[model samples]
Target: MVIRGAGRLTAAAVGVAVTVATAVGLVLTPSSAKVEPAMVADPGPPEVTISIALGGATHGYVNPDVALAQGGTLTIANGDGVLHTVTSDALGTSGDPLFGFSVPARTTRSFALPSLAGGAYGFYCVFHPGMRGTLTVIGGPVGEVPAPPSFDQALRIPKVLSGDHITIPMKKADVRIMADGPKTTMWTYGGSYPGPTIERRAGQQTKVTFVHKLPKDAGSMTVHHHGGHQSSADDGQPTKHLIEKGAKRTYTYALRDAGKPAPAAFNFYHDHRMHVTARNNWRGLQGMFLITDPKEKKLGLPTGKYDVPLHFSDRSFTASNQLSDPFGHAAHSGHGGMPGWMTGEHAPPNDATVGQRILVNGQYAPYLTVKPGLYRLRLLNASLFSAYDFALSDGSAFTQVGTGSGLLPAPVTRQDVLLGPAQRADVVVDFRGKAGQDVLLSTIPRSDSTGTGSRNAALMQFRVRGTTSQKARVPGKLRPLAPLKGVPGKVSKTWTFDLSEMHSGGQHGSFWSINGKMFKASRMDHKVRMNSVEKWKLRNTSDMTHYVHLHQEQWHTLSRDGDEPPPWEQGLEDTWRLDPGEEVVVAARFTDFPGVFMLHCHMLDHEDHGMMAQFEIVR
Candidate 1:
């Protein structure tokens, strides 16, 4: 048995150039013949001059002011070897053609930007979202960006499994196909529970030696680097053709640094193992993959004594304490939790009540003992369909740390942290009360924590054990993030969606929808160029709050309908719950990697219950 190497990766300063660092065949490699260079002596890519600094030529910012006059030629220099493009959203909102000009390594091309006016233009690497730049065109005063984050040298990171982390194990579950309950099935990574946690440094390498232990019916196990960009092969797409059960495959990949002043505070990983993402993730085949880049680590933010990654989830258990995949046949589940939602293709009485009694990692009602001082609880709502307008029982405040995509430059104290399905919050809760006193955690009012049958509560009792040592204290601030650059004028398009409940068949089919319809291939959501900004609005009509989430991209929560916290909601989030009859707006940009992605409710049941939609992005 050969053990796969969790290799070391260098945080090489990136300007522009894709290095074919290493490639090991996942399953097997065939014999090949070597070829000698026939024409060139020192063969390499056609070299051109490039600006290796962050921004402009690299993944950072361009000079604050645009030097262009009227009808000046715009130059797109490719620092990264992989194919790239310079696109704009000035044409139209939907279906805008991209400026597909290829700049090989070190190459640069000039194009005309007619009638240059003062505005912000977004740029990105066609292959990687992390590689992006901001172009500010100024005929007037330009904008200013905050200073980058400063990292502390003593950030505590468990040396083992810290950077370039990998793990492999038997995937077992009662796989569901369009819902119904428990059947014999195999899973990858996180068995019938949230899978393994793969942690790594910002710039590192990892490879998984995966073996399919499924039945003869299935032979696929793919790992989806949920927050990864650049390398598409590691995206973990399952194919009909796979290594047979009992056979193994090794997947290797590198974590390229996104040259920001700060580090990516949080990211998640899960099984992209193909057609079973819904089933595998639903069957507890899910876990968190964290990246602690060196830059952020150096930030003197709260260390191990305060920071903790808390996964939140909710599950319904039977009298026997067995978790039944009630999300099967979600079509039969009520607007809340209904029966026949977890099982695959099985039917049951649609009126059955589904109450989630257990909170696993990110679940409801999980207990955690804390000290009587300030403790930063990194809460991740990894639930299938639960959202928390979370607040402390005594009405304590939570100093928010970060969102889905990354962290902000400063901390914002929040009264209630609202997390839709898949949404997360880095909150610093000060346990300043008496030690040994019991603290009760509860969900905020708007969250409707009470379930359909009664009140829904995601809280658990937290008993303070002791006081913290003075040597360890929460930092004045957490990791700072790259300043949010400006976007072009209203050149972007508009997108709208509606969420509501429906009644179908003889039973009350509990589900919501976008744009008043379910996901249909024939129906196009919206199309846009590679780099552009657009305003998206989600109108909720259902009685329950549906947290809508987007993948592969990060969006900023602009504002809610009321005086509710909008600035606090500005963290990078993949999931956000829409309270009943409330409308939320998001300022978003669709960067490189032209493809179609799914946008669904964070509530797994709501998503499987037909509350899902898809959008397309093109170059």
Candidate 2:
């Protein structure tokens, strides 16, 4: 009998037959004609094999239900980059597992089910309770197996805190990403997943005191005011001014651009520890920071309740609803391939960590009720590695009025906005005539061929209801942006992003790097003259996409691969996406305070690895 394993089995068993025939000749003797009957051994029960794997984010298990003969084999394959298990639910208690065998990532295992009785049994993964399946035992050959809900929760806007002197406590709290999901423990700012929105007027001096209340093992914390023009002491360098556990540290922001009121902008604050930046941010120590210039009130954009800040991020949880370790064996390498280093050992610092679930404002596919009018949406991509191509479900256009640092000179109409990690876009979405309709804010699938991109498409929903008498329109001219002056054909410096092989602590692997060198705290890669405008060329030589981010100052994109930048990139920007082998030229005038600042990939995993460098501004 031949045993075969396939993704699906249409029939239960394969049959084997043996035929015996005796030929008699007329001239043959009786003794010679009588041939001994060939003895045949009986073939017992035929064995059937069923093959299944871990489906992508959307589908929990490829074949959730399957039938197998009483005496057959079950082959389990884990195609994902993460570790998963196939355990009988009937053998173990809720939290204490007593039965299932472990299956490492990117491996296959076979189990014999001959000893089990002819009945139905349930199974699940020990790491992920959400992953469950059913297996049935039949007396005969197994036949074909059979196959396999939406967002209705209200959006939870982060609590707003506005004052010159604000205090936020960093502590662990129990929060729920999905309305019906289990409670997840997260390291939050002021006990919230997104912390609190810190709103301040431009030109005002604000000081925020962060009290470190997380467990001692949480390590020292540093708060980075992303996109802020602050001094080196407050820039949140990995080793500068850390807030130790049970201690407090204050960060001061001038909120000014060279002694003048800074243009109204959207920024954010998050943890930026040295090697744990990715893990810290993934645990939820981030929030939105808004700088408002009273002068912009004349533009008449959406304000008050009509203005909304949507923070997008992706995460994965364990069976107990705790954040999964991005570098752990059970965690999925967001890059879609296995880590270059060993599993169950020290993590490969360069691997990208992508999550299975996408969230908006800390809620899983939540909904926001809106009035029939124009509203301003402040969009921020806070995820560790994923980049979202945001679009409306109805195929409506968004009037983009602002880039990363501040408002654009004019509103550019865009059908969809692509935001890399740590990038922000301010757009005006009009729902004027679409009352009583549910419009979903969804993301386009990633075009890159690296990893299995996010399966969750819908980020949130906009439930347009009620009527408003006010008519708001995006102005043709929103602000004045003076282009950075730079001499043509003169390049100040060029930075290349690539991957380099390194041997550290007896482990050898390829790590992300800038200019073929890993990050060194004592090394400075570039020095720029203060208040001098210079053009710089950025290049990506690696095989994967990268989101390049510069601290302290926002720059203007001069050209992308020798072509003018897109409408959304025409404004002052701090982060730029670089596909494999793509190059970009940008110009910026170094001003204000800049002692030692960082320039690196915004993908937190890449940043945490060695794909970062430091620069200094000299007078």
Candidate 3:
């Protein structure tokens, strides 16, 4: 039993209990936790029995269609010919996989769901999306439900990169992080704390002669390309190999100059190692990959006179020690997050009160003075897992120009927008101002981590400083992005991910996993042909929402977040996010990878907590 995402602190306890029981073939019961008293409130309607079927021919049933109490429980039955797992992201349901009952075919399995409040919950099968069901808690005031994340109109802060002639020393330099500080090692690049930022255009290959720079280095780290193409050996993955301290290793990968034609939108580089990434990135070793295109330059979009690179993130730290990862929740990270953070009901705080630092391009409370004309922002969400909904301090609309697929066919003006764990949006904000007026650029507070809802807090601040020209105007159209042709009729092979589980303790913490397995460092699951296009249909059957991510391939979303494929998604990609209960159909052409690649949860903790698996691309 593994809980998929337990926002509740019950994750640690639950995980420990299940692991022991599995090994002994007996359930280990722990004393129920003492409950804190809550002032009473209005009751919700009785739940109706909603019968759902899993595995087309194999159907499982869940009774009591809806759960209305804050921490109520529901009983589910397994009636399918095959085994079934029931999981949710309700309050205490961390990404544990034990809450699930693995009833054999023809037998019945029962599961008791513990407490789920009034908001909508996401549930899915780790086996198949075709095997999905939803439990909508009704009887609440309409507005109480969070509004879906919107592209509400707002102003855009100008964008800028370290626009520099980047040079990775031809010779490898041994380096180490200085942890002998008041707190943990402040982040560093190359060798020194806060490793130097590298800036370059697309179509350029960065040659890195990597050398283990740490003394007694027991762990490994790699430079990950945050862009779409992640297949080449250059894409970071410790398992691929390691460069030892004092020994030099060269890694030369090309970056298509955005100023010319390119393979991806602007991207960034960061370390993706487990456990250590959160600490390293928070300390400031993250940098941007600025890709410019002649097509974009010709668009008459906001140019240098008004561009800004606003890297937004939320972090919590004390004057000396950065607050440790919340016992279970992952605030701003993709790896080593506890399963508890993914499925729990603990909504993230909206203000930066508990958190002490905010950096924009590596500087605290970064102040970038802007000109009054139209300012284009190359916004980056470099935080580990914190998501945001943003708008101008004063209500204003911002023109959206590009996203995962690059500049839309035209400039799209939207209100508030959703920036998920690793998603980005390029916008143009026109500041109609006196030369030195201050305009604060910020994001809203957010609550539910599963869906695009809730405004967590103000993500950043931008001040309008320089003079403006009345001559600036936002064109109705920016660039033309056509969708790629699909390989629909060719359904070579199909796979489904039914997210079910609430398991506890093992070597890794309890977590939500596909089938009944967590991510094992040495396991390889799927073997495929490189360059073969296939369809993967994903469905979320758990109460909590899971962000499913794939490595070595950035696939296209067939349908999701109300986005239908325009002419662009027809090509290939390396990542696609799947929301709960929502089915996303995607096609990918894996042209590389002689060995296995990984396809798992984007929620890093869930991946580390055993919510991951491997896929091999062979001959």
Candidate 4:
């Protein structure tokens, strides 16, 4: 069993009873550690159950954290106050198949591993990066599984916008996508990986119905429409409402009366399933959701074919060409300051999954054939764990036109722009005179890794082709931004992001905290009035990095620490990353959404572990 996400902790003692029992002809020794068997009146199946105690800085295994049973069910119970996942491919080794189960708060869950010829299996929380254990399967033949086919998609994936009212069916379909090799299987939506881009205009009421036609075992899914202010039901908060396999749900994004209309910006829709988000998204369950305004569109910017939405992500592939979790199966990258958690003894304080290869719009080092003119590129750093500092190979300057929120005050010429996970930027690249130049889109080293600029540097290539008659313009002023001073509510809350450790209960791992508390879904961390704007002070107390994200509202940065925010952050934004010990002040207003919303780290693994918290929006 695998548990994901963060929450409270617990402690318990394993029973000392010594009863040697046999189930399905498999010998079992009574464990010195505490554990419970199935509560069925009659022994239903050959199974071994492990009780997990989760609490402050601790994830305790009641048993030896190893097993000798063969071909049976493995049960795990979460006796904690938050959601968790038990992912068997915790080390992400190629020999082990990825299997996960969500152990909800204070609940027990089980999974069957019937064809188990195993040696040692490592399991960990998809959420808690540092919490892991090993389970040894003895008396079974150990062998390797067959490798998957190579995955290489040679075409440039385009961004598509859904119609005004569209019905999107979510089902398990195999898609052929290649990044650098042959075709590989991709779990997809509507038969396409990354699904299909859904585009909408501000003030337009769009109703989208998601039909879950996935296989019975594909697990539940929910599409979180980030950067939209609608309602709690439509917000797609994790662990709240999910579309079970064969089930369906409709979300209405009624921005018709969202109060003076938030800025039109680049948003995205991705799977936010409880406990299995990292795997789900890594398996190709994400897409672009762009919001546009007519006035901004009429500014004669790069439109139509010239306007490109580039989704950048990094991925690791197994020898068989299957998508593998870098967190698991990967060699511990000791780059930057990452805690070599893969092989190290203790959990690293905070770690991010950095991939070995980069993908641009689902293509590996793809070349974009562009005319000698200006093109508007909507850049999204969709990498699950990596942050990037993007620049041209030739070091030419590009103008940043917009941010994740919307249009900037003016275009800022920059030689390089840093993008953290889940962050977006709109850039204007001019290729008029550089027609024959093959410019490489390179990335700088991330905060978590050492300078890998030479290894996985270039993301994509821009092949300047024939000439085009299209003209693009960058206006001096894009739009008017709201003043932070007169925004409504007072300074309502302050959240501190930090690291905590649990040294007792026979458990040890580094965990993330907000205001010194781990994330608890059942607990509402804060509350706010609807339609009232409030200022939030976010302080990063940890010695690592965190990208703070708030759902439903596109807020404005009031200031960073004590000084004013830079031009890039002064617009409508949904996410921001803070360096260690850095403090930032941002303001947001609750509109029609009146329910529980989330404010958490966007470094998905961290959020899954414990760096996430929620607040209530009341009427």
Candidate 5:
């Protein structure tokens, strides 16, 4: 006879009487005789089915705790559209799982539980540690269950690739973006979502080979060294040279600006395929590039593991954990469709794509454990369109030491740092006083004129623990940056950015334009004499925001709407944000290898549509 109880029976109490009666076969005599007639029509062990829940980590299992017979059949139905596993907790002296069953996405699997002394059994998803549950058996000895893991997982830092010659292959990989989410299939570089960090010295020359291994449907590709000053042949012109499937290309970087060592800065590399830049970049072809100099090491700053690079981006996933294509639907469709004026035979490019999920270094809201000390954070806004106003939840201020191009002459204390798409910032954050506290790095939402801003606010968490004896300080003076050698108010060129309608292929459609002209691949919009310093005025007439990024040389902002530039804008910058009806004057010197380079909106969706133009520096 089976007996069930909330508490286990004492061995001492049951051993003397129960053991003697069971050994003599007297315990089951009356019960077995009464059930003998019913045993002939036994219907086998009981069966129960459990479902893996949908949504996020909060909803783990449909029936988390279940009680069943000792040897019942257990079935797991996985309808979450991603692979999952039912793994028992560690048991026995060796600490191995008692039983495990693999269940694919949208499928079911069944297994019979081993007959053992009854107790509570703990189980969890192998892929997602946050998913856990308990199973209770009716009659048996009690088992010890370990506590489940927390929702926060350690942040994953990308491996660094440093060498004279580097070869990176592009392919598809399944990556886990959240601690409690399914694996997502993404096009990756070196089989990683954000690829690998490429580190190089300021004055070193490096040769990089990009091998295309993506599916044929992915089509041609191009890699743009966003802030590198290289020759035209290696500049990754969107329409000129292309890397097809099963093909490879080599790009050589001299790492010099007009025979001078390039400034040490944190930059990025990404896809630049014409008409599909947004699509390819959204799929995961992006990475961080760091340029170092020996002289900068003299400054007292954090190094090695203490210095962290945080890349911020956004993504949306389907129920099956696949990336949602922002441009896959018909332009006129009411749901997630393009603007009404964007109808055409070809797929219409999106105005902007803001995802609900915010990812830091390819993971969702990961936490970084740090010792109590000062840390240097290199922040990059790699998203396709979303801009972030970064701040710490504790309301602590950080020291801003650098901008996109390089270090600033003097450090400035800032309550928050604002970065547009393709922009970067170097800051030093002090966590010595915040030990045993958890601080969140989050974004303060700004008003979006296009109504496509990201809803996600939290970026990551910093769990402060441990002690540190290391002493490092942010120097008041870090580097020297000279002003651009150009007249203050002299405007060499005036470019107007606006949204306008154009007639093409016997149809009228809206397009983002610069200076009232759409992009033409074979056309050169402007020409400048090499080694000439010039000032340009950029005016945004449209209601939406635009991020202007220039290639080849970094520029200094002279004024914003006829007012002095902010402290963050006083340093050398490669990108600037222009609000509605705002005009910014910037000064730049066109030098180095003279060739055709691009100047366009860093909002990739706008650039892919028509907001790009080319300029040539003639010797």
Candidate 6:
């Protein structure tokens, strides 16, 4: 069966209970009943400015954490183009301290911290889940220290869910995840970090009843069947059918094939809770969805244990071995709808939280024992940010087979395979006759496939074992893809990705926008004719990378920067990460079913920050 990646969630700081009103109620009167000037008090001690630096996917702010004195005024500058809030449950006595304090994009907000006992305090942006920091209130002189990741041994692979139809319960549980040298507490589904994999067959109907049993503080959830082309009601779009704590909803997928010639492929399912997606996913509310067909299987591709589904992601840990960053939960007044600007209506373009440790199936530097033969490796870039250019340390070439959506026209042999957030690639690793060999799977940093040079960082390892007579081979003629040279589609529309507002103080932080407008769920940015093929051009105007993803249907990448895409991208794809100032054209036919689908940056944080837009497919 084909495979895709899922998301995860974690826990944050806990302190006293309090509530604060974020909105100010305005009183109406006849000409505003002699509004008096608000009393201007004497300005207190000057604040120490802490700028929230935004850059790179997977790494939002350069200084996400900070240290300060116990009793001092603070100024936090939102250096990106998005709204943010610095709230700590450790602060305030009567209410949620974050309620009235919000820092607009490219602006700064100052606040006075009540004199407190010297200790550590955690803070985060209410709008962006992964945007978190630590405040070490030094009493005397010693400063605060940042927590490091917990890494350890390679454990058993993440559990895979079988059976054609099944019941998936989204529950609150805990699992010990080892990364670099230690095991950390990770919130999970079915007591596993990645939950379980769900498998199905093409042209077969499947029923999945998602039961939610998470605690109230864990927040509400809706399961999005990512990469599934189903009706709107079954799409699991946020706010459509949310299962609050203790509530359950069953989503049924007809699971028919798109009939696009490409072999059956894999996708993923995860929590799409309107606002807290980053946190919920960071807590591990995601799993894989697999679809099988006779065509690909008959080709004698690696099946069963030999065909592996690998999920690549990164996460950070607190000093106590608890999940930090995206794992921490923020206490927002409520979920859904547009938030106030000060609270950040959207996420900044550079707000993709990259973790410190790269994990494969929840294991740090995991080593997979593979038979000395051919193995079909399904690679899914499940990271919230971070695009990877995969290559073998031993200089072994990877035979490109297929992708998250389906198989390519033919296999392409190359050393490096670039995968962005939410993207997938299926490759055949020929380990034939090589026993007791340790091959390192590394990532080429900033390997955008531009004319620039590339750097390498080791990710995971492959330990080759005994040989097998059951030879798994890559078919000479895999599948046929449509010729992009004469693809039948007009350049009907164009979408440009860039900053909407340059924030208040001209800080580097800016809100991600399409066509110069922030995302609004109620707004329909585009309209498509049902079952009609159309080509859309995407232009990235920002200096950061943006992975564009379209829902409901997989698209055929026609060209990149007026040139043919890499051979690996010749087939259908649901997401493509574009570098700064890059332009690409893709074609898609919205068939089967379509209502209101989203087209957005796959950097989940960016999507949460208003970089997403909706389009309707009309009959």
Candidate 2 lDDT over 1-619, as tens digits, reads: 0001111111121111101000000011111112112122332234433333444222456776776655566666766534344544332111111123334445576655534444455555432335657666655323222110156699888999889999999999998786765788899999998989999999999999999999998999999999998889999989778999999999999998777877778999999998789879988999999998888888889898889999998765554556655443324342324343322222332245555457789876688999989999999999887677788878899999998689998999988887879999999999989999988887754433332232225567799999998756777898887866664568898999987765545545556789998789999999988888878899998645689998887688889988998877888889998876789999888888758999999888678778899999988
By lDDT, the candidates rank as: 5, 2, 4, 6, 1, 3
* lDDT of model 6, residue 218: 74
Model 6, span 600-619: residue lDDT tens? 88777667666887888899
Name the top TM-score candidate. 2
- Model 1 misplaced regions, further than 4 Å: 1-160, 163-165, 173-192, 205-211, 215-262, 271-279, 297-299, 327-355, 362-371, 444-455, 472-486, 491-495, 499-512, 520-524, 541-543, 562-565
What value does the lDDT take at residue 429 in candidate 4? 89
Q: What is the TM-score of each candidate against the true structure?
A: 0.58, 0.75, 0.61, 0.71, 0.73, 0.72
Compared with the true structure, all predictions reach lDDT values of 0.46, 0.70, 0.45, 0.63, 0.70, 0.63
Cα lDDT over the full model 5 = 0.70
Ranked by TM-score from best down, the candidates are 2, 5, 6, 4, 3, 1
Candidate 4 runs further than 4 Å off: 1-155, 179-181, 325-351, 446-456, 484-490
| Model 5 residue 18 CA deviation in Å | 64
RMSD, every candidate, angstroms: 27.5, 15.1, 12.2, 15.1, 17.0, 13.2
Which regions in candidate 2 have their CA more than 4 angstroms from the true location?
A: 1-148, 328-350, 447-456, 486-489, 503-507
At residue 187, give the lDDT of candidate 3. Answer: 40
Error of 5 at 232 (Å): 1.6
Give a tens-digit lDDT track for model 4, residues 34-117. Answer: 122212233233677766675511434556265645556778776754444444431112212233444544667666653434
lDDT, candidate 3, 1-619, per-residue tens? 2112221112223323221011000111111111122223555434333344443323324442354444334434444433233333222322222222233323333233333334555444332323445454433332121111111122233232233333332122222211222434444454332344344555655565545454444355566666635344666663565444445555555553213335446566666665444444544456565655555555577776466666665444333433333333334342244433333222111001111223344433334555667877877666554445666756678877777436665666677665655566778887765456544555543332334232223333455665655354566766543443555564444334443434343312224566566556687666777666677666665434455666655455565534675432333333454544565677666664466566665544445455566777777
Tell me how many clashing residue pairs each candidate has: 61, 2, 127, 27, 3, 36
lDDT of 3 at 373: 71
Give residue 587's error in model 5 in angstroms.
Answer: 1.6
